[model samples]
Target: MKVLAAMSGGVDSAVAAARAVAAGHDVTGIHLALSRNPKSYRTGARGCCTIEDSNDARRAADVIGIPFYVWDLSDAFHEEVVEDFMAEYAAGRTPNPCLRCNEKIKFAAVLDRGMALGFDAVATGHYAQLRTGDDGMIEMHRALDHAKDQSYVLGVLTQEQLAHSLFPLGDTTKDVVRREAADRGLLVADKPDSHDICFIADGDNAGWLREKLGDRNPNTGGDIVDSATGEVLGHHEGTVGFTIGQRRGLRLGVPAPDGKPRFVLDIEPVSGTVSVGPRAGLQIDRITGIRPRWCGTVPEVLDGPAVTVQLRAHGAEHRAVVAVRPAGASSEGAPMGVASDGSGSGSVEIELLEPAEGIAPGQAAVIYDGSRVVGSATISGTGRSHALAQTLQRVAT
Candidate 1:
């Protein structure tokens, strides 16, 4: 089989390509030049767009005895990933750019182009497994090393992509991948993995957005009201700057009467006010996910027993009961009275055993059943209504 391997100048991809070659597959390495200006990468940062990274990929390809090339996808990346990231934040939604990049650039654009150029499949350094089902359908499974699993970030992949996708390092731990690269005389063997978001090189996403979008005046400060009473207790620059369950940076001079620190209970971007309350106020029983997508065909209903739902990659999968919501009942805007079954519009509600915190709108909520990834959806909004108080009382008893 002819495979096109994505080498990011990282040890994981280096070992992955070597493993593919050892498996009797013809593999070639390609480093994506996602950034037009590679020199913009910081001195210490090992971002994907750096000249050093491209050189590392070429060297690794040479060590593995494979043809190597650099493909520039900067235009598509800027359009689909970077621009969308800034726009989502400007619209008061925290977007996951990594997930978007996987969906648009890695899977859609790169995979299509590679296949057109006569490559049978596209391989990557992702720590997720792909298996073929009895009916010839490709199924995506969790990586063997749960701590280093990257299935959540690749949740947006389509079933067709999974059929031709290769993840050689899925079953191997990070340490093992690094050791394999070292054994093969690869230079990035002991290099630390890059953890920052690739495009934002630095972690200043908000600052990057501000530079892209015109400098909108910092809106006047407003009261950080209590979620229960609408009573103004403190002032804040704007609610948009805050997320749902943020604990610190609430500049409220007075401590919560109970001695515990105040947590951001809610952020009302419309009123430009944030609501501060005790930590208990952030707990929620249920969450709604929108724009749902699954590797397999959508189920008629997701009700069987308790399943696992992941709000973010590298986070615990919470045990939850899944239900298909009527297409447009919850806010975040959809046509009302639409399909109640999961087949039509693909909206869902994963009712957790307890409330999960740090869940923000526009993030993905991926569901899993055992080791297999079931599906995922965007968090259109949250359900922090008056009913939460009654739910909390029930939990307390």
Candidate 2:
């Protein structure tokens, strides 16, 4: 097999590429140069594809004795991942940029280019397992190291992408992978794993967004209103500075009547309103998802054993019953009619058996049947449990 190994200058990817070579595959390594100005992104061990990272990848490739090259994906990455991140945040929604990068840049752009060059598959360091099911379709599953599993981010991949993808480190733990890297003489063996958004040089997301958005920012300042009282408790520099679950750094001048800490319940970008309330208001039992992407066969409905949905990249899974239908379909057994926001994409309605908290729109909801990924969808809306809604209503009255 001709494998195109994506070496990210990290221990996992270096070991993955090495393992691919040891398996007798004709492996060629490549590092994605995602930023046009490499210095603008994170440097040192905190970065993923910085200039230093590219050099590290090259060295790792040399150690593995494989042909290596750097692909300039800056333009594609900027339009797809970076722009999309700002746009999602501007619309008052929280998005996972890593998921977007995997969907648009890694699998879509890189895979297409690799196949054009006659490569059979593109392997990465992602900790997610792939297997052929009874139907002979490629099925993605959780990695052996549950703590390091990254299947949630890779959930956006389609059946075709999964077919041409290889994840060699999926069955191994992080410690073992690092040990293998050291044994194989890869220097990145001890490099700390990159955290936070790669493109953001500093971890301050709000400041970065404010500077990048500039004139396009909807509101320079807005009121942080209490949901229960509709009273303006404080003001914010921007609605993008807050997210659904945020409880700290609110700088609210007024305390809640109940004296309980308030969590951001909602963000209305157009109205410049950030609603705060008791944590109970954050509980939601239903999620409406758009742009459903299936890993293999698309099921009409998923229920019973192993049916679950993960809302965040590393968040716990919620046992759920999911129903798939065309966008704008009737709300039958689901909580609401799934709308595609005029994109005409398919929709997924997920009913969590147990309620989830602080679920925000624009986040990916990856559905699974036990270890195998069924599909994923972008969350568009959420609904509180009826009982909870009634309780809140009573409290309000």
Candidate 3:
């Protein structure tokens, strides 16, 4: 079988490619040049597609005795991932660009191109296991090393993409993977892991946005309003720095009703208004999500059985009842509804066992049935109409 390995100049990817070659598959390495100006990578920060990183990937591919090439997908990355990131933030929602990259670039665009070039599968350094279930359908599970598990970021992948995907380091820890790379003389073995968002290389997101959108940006910041009484508490420069469940840097001199700290309960980008209230205002017993993407065929039941819903990356998985309408009967513009049985298909309404905080639109809600990933959807909106009381818990939404 011909396989294409995505080498990101990281030890994990280098080892994944080596494992693919050892499995007797005809393997080739490709480093995606995601940034046109690779030299502009942040000082003392690690990121993908850097000129230095690409060189390291090429060296690793050479050590593994495989043909290597750099694929320039910078334009696509800018359009799909970078632009989408800015748009989501500008729209008063937090977005995970890594998930979008996997959904659109690595697994979709790169896989399609590789398949057209006769590669049977596209292998990556992602830490997630693909297993054959009892029914013979491919299932994705958390990697053995939970700390390194990347399944959450990959929840956007469809079954078609998973069919030809290979993850070689899912069963091992990061330390061991680096050790293996060291044994094979791969230079990235000692390379630090990439931290924060890759595109925001300096770890200064607000600064980066200021550069892109400028001072007269449309989604510019506005007043921080009170969620309960609609009174303006304070003013903010931008909403990009705020997300749901945020408790710090609010700088709101006014105290809550109980004289406790205030939290960001909601953000309205169109109106340039932010709603602040007690932390309890973040709890939502009900959630409405749209644009559901299944890793496999849509499940047989329109109404879901009990499942675990993962809202944030590495966030706690909460027990919930997820019900989908039949064949997408729910219009995209329709208001939120109760997650009752039957009707729409592509959308889901989730009822959590316990009210969760930090639920935000534009975030991915990945549903898991046991260890296998069932499906995932983007959060369109959240509701605290059911539980508006102030409550704090160890688990975050």
Best by lDDT: 2
Worst lDDT 10-window in candidate 3? 335-344
Clash pairs, candidate 1, are 284-355
Give the Cα error of residue 279 in candidate 2, in Å: 0.5
**Residues forming the 10-long window of minimal summed lDDT in candidate 2:** 335-344
Q: What's the C-alpha lDDT at position 294 in model 1?
A: 68
For each candidate in turn, the TM-score is 0.88, 0.94, 0.90
Candidate 2 residue lDDT tens string, 245-332? 8999999988888798999999999989999998888989989998888887767899997899999999999999999876444556
List the global CA lDDT of all models.
0.77, 0.90, 0.82
Cα-based RMSD of candidate 3: 4.9
- Residue by residue across 291-347, what tens digits does model 3's lDDT show? 777777565333345478889888988888887754423467443332221112367
Model 2, residue 163: distance off in Å is 0.6
| 10 residues in a row with least lDDT, candidate 1 | 335-344
Task: Judging by TM-score against the true structure, name the best candidate.
Answer: 2
- Mind giving the per-residue lDDT tens digits that candidate 1 earns over 1-397? 8999999888888888999999999999999998868665433527377888888999999999999999999899989987787666655677788889988899889899999999999889999998887878778889999999999998887777787899998888988888888899999998888876776657665455555555552333567987767777788755445666778677777766668777777665556777877777667667888777667655445644547888876787788877765555457655454333222355777777656887778888888777777777888876654677787767646
State how far residue 306 of model 3 sits from its true place (Å).
6.9
